[model samples]
Target chain A: MIGWKQIPPGMVILEAGSALKIKTGSWRAAYKPRWIEENCIQCLLCWLYCPDNAVKVEDGKRQDFDYEYCKGCGLCALECPGKKGNKAIVMEEEVR
Target chain B: MVTPLNLKELSKKELRFTAGHRLCAGCAAPTVVKMILLAACDYPVVVASSTGCLEVSSCISTYTAWKVPWIHSAFENAAATLSGVESMYKALKKQGKIDKEIKFIAICGDGGTYDIGLQSLSGAMERWHDMLYVCYNNEAYMNTGIQRSGATPTYADTTTCPAGSVIPGKPQPRKDLTKIMAAHGIPYVAQAAPSHWPDLMKKVRKALEIPGPKFMNIFTPCNRGWRTRTDDAILLSRLAVDTCFWPLYEVEKGVVRVTYKPKEKKPIEEFLKLQGRFRHLFEPGREQLISELQRMIDENWERLLKEEEIFASKEEEKEEVVK
Candidate 1:
């Protein structure tokens, strides 16, 4: 019957500023998908629902993602409005 | 010499759900999946995941992190799929094809468990299948960008139920899932969270040992969906339990026993203020909603204590009869 108020020290207690210190560099490249020019129709679903505003469209056609801001959240890849065979954007691993 | 049971030692050495998977930072589903696997160990387990965050992140057709036998069915059929697996295992055991005891687990999000898959889950529970059902309840359909689910807390903001001029996010309270499972007279039903790792591990072990149906609703924090810091996953779970927003308890043999109760329960605002989902609750005229939420928690806590008292009295009566 451990008392609730006495949270043990070093028990991984989560504080407000804890997230600010975590290095998110590892998560950034985990799912940054590249668009294939051959298959892309540029429906812009990826751009519209970027969540992190990672995707950008040029002249309402060519789609590009700024990987620095992209947390690799995968919303763009999932919500692509392109037809099944003609997907405008496809998830490709970030090239080292 | 005192022998210590290193619970982590009971976990499988093989890494099934490897790191670098595509789940959102601080998503609760992965923790639930990991704990279930750790509890099951190498028991020839086969998992059926619903079409939610856990399924999409772990089994995206082209990329999969699962090392064991796993299947992804529709959003509302994980229970049915696991039931089929259990039936198959039983048939195979009868014919001597498989001699060892195997475990079948169904994993789903709150949407799948409380809303869409409720019928299938109820049917499986009614049939008394030898399967463990885990609901990674992050309170919404997180994979679809935070839509409201039946398990969503009252006044929590979601895409569909946004806090706006007229409405202050979700209007209804969270569905009582543990009571629902207990109503089916299941052998075991428990509510657990990752923040309480030891308690969670103990419940998982006990649930797995039971021969009949077992349901565990695990409160997992969704950093993106809940609008909280990515690192606050464990903290959010702790706050939920401490505020009595999510009581940690287990129901065994139709008797309810609260596993943990906080002393000087923290205010609901302490829990709500951290998450963006409940930000609207702080607005003017929203104090009523907060009070309503507090009243609900108080009522539920009282009911739980009353149930424990009744259970104790019943045990005493049985003891007198035996004497």
Candidate 2:
């Protein structure tokens, strides 16, 4: 698993450093896409469209996203075609 | 007429554009941009915009509503070009060439923010430049005739993601760009809809106050794209927030707080049903998409609550130590 320390500088890292601050308060939030393996067709669309190379593949199949630098833009879910009977990719909210 | 109580009240009365700007009747972008300018009235603002509906309508070379300094760049490079303008401003400030405090703002559509301009947006935000980036998200690329964009909601029918015999409309959900901006660790990031004028104004003021990069993603409705009534833009914005589809909140210094939480959250269908883009989702088998959308909202609300609890507890601990 890639940790916060593993993120390289100049890269867009999700859930790293301080939470986004506004005038009202801070938000310790992270955007991560959940993969439902049962629904995945091994289409590899999620891996192909991820802007930050956050998704990984194993044995020529889709794997989990490496959140270390995943900006959680939800492009993977947007691009994933395995969303018919069961949505293979879903955007989830995580509190840091 | 009686004099106004504040500058804001007075500025509203003296708009440069009378009423005949080329923007569609229900377009929320023009109003949001006006609000931003009103809030940042303290500084000399230079606006760099992308080739979207807003730019196309306001800037026709010979005639324009942009009274302040402005430039219309390509669809994908407003952020990058604005970064250059900001750098030049800084150098000029140090050399005493430009002594005034000038604010730089980059305005773009969803196509620019989530698709073509994503790289430039990242570059500008990463550089920690003193600027405010506003994404006037109308959900699709309306300037190009209602094409699908990364910001379009799930299951919504667009020209690109149209429902066909083999496939339903846009099968995937909208991109969570707010979370993406927050991950950059910028000083300010928030989502505002023009329907909530007070909230949008407050966030704009806060973003201007921040010394580092600030990003505000505003949900502007498009009558042309969504196939809605021309006068329903404000109503649509209000419904979006009231239904919990678009929560009104802000994140400050790593603490997440809800600015406005509905006492009784309305059904998501109320907001979805108004727009024709989501018409297909109301059909059979597509019911699952609605449930999934609800689940996503619920998940986000739960996470927001947990964040508040953690931060509140930490504050309580600090208070106990003080005692």
Q: Give the 10-residue window scoring lowest on summed lDDT in candidate 1 chain B.
A: B1-10
What digit string (tens of lDDT, one per residue) describes model 2 on residues A1-96? 346577556333233112111111111145567888888887664543343335666545567866654555455565466847667988778766
Task: Give interface RMSD, per candidate.
Answer: 18.0, 20.4
Q: What is the per-residue lDDT of model 1 for residues B260-297, given as tens digits with 9 covering 90 to 100?
A: 98988998889989989988888887799888889999
- B1-323 in candidate 2: lDDT tens per residue? 43222332433333322222356533667667766665665666888888898887765434455666777668888988898899999998899898887888888899999998898898899999899999999999999899999998877788998876656777787888888888888888888987566677788778887898888898888878998855466678889988888887777766667788888998899999998887777888778878888898788777877877888899889999999
lDDT of 1 at B274: 93
- TM-score for chain A, candidates 1 onward in order: 0.57, 0.64
- Model 2 chain A lowest lDDT segment of ten: A19-28
Cα deviation of B119, candidate 2, in Å: 0.9
User: Candidate 1 residues A1-96, lDDT tens each?
Assistant: 235556445332233122223223356654466776676665554443343334555544555666644566554554455655666666666655
- What is the DockQ score of candidate 2, to 2 decimals? 0.01
Off by over 4 Å in 2: A1-96, B1-19
For model 1, what is the alpha-carbon lDDT of residue B281? 83
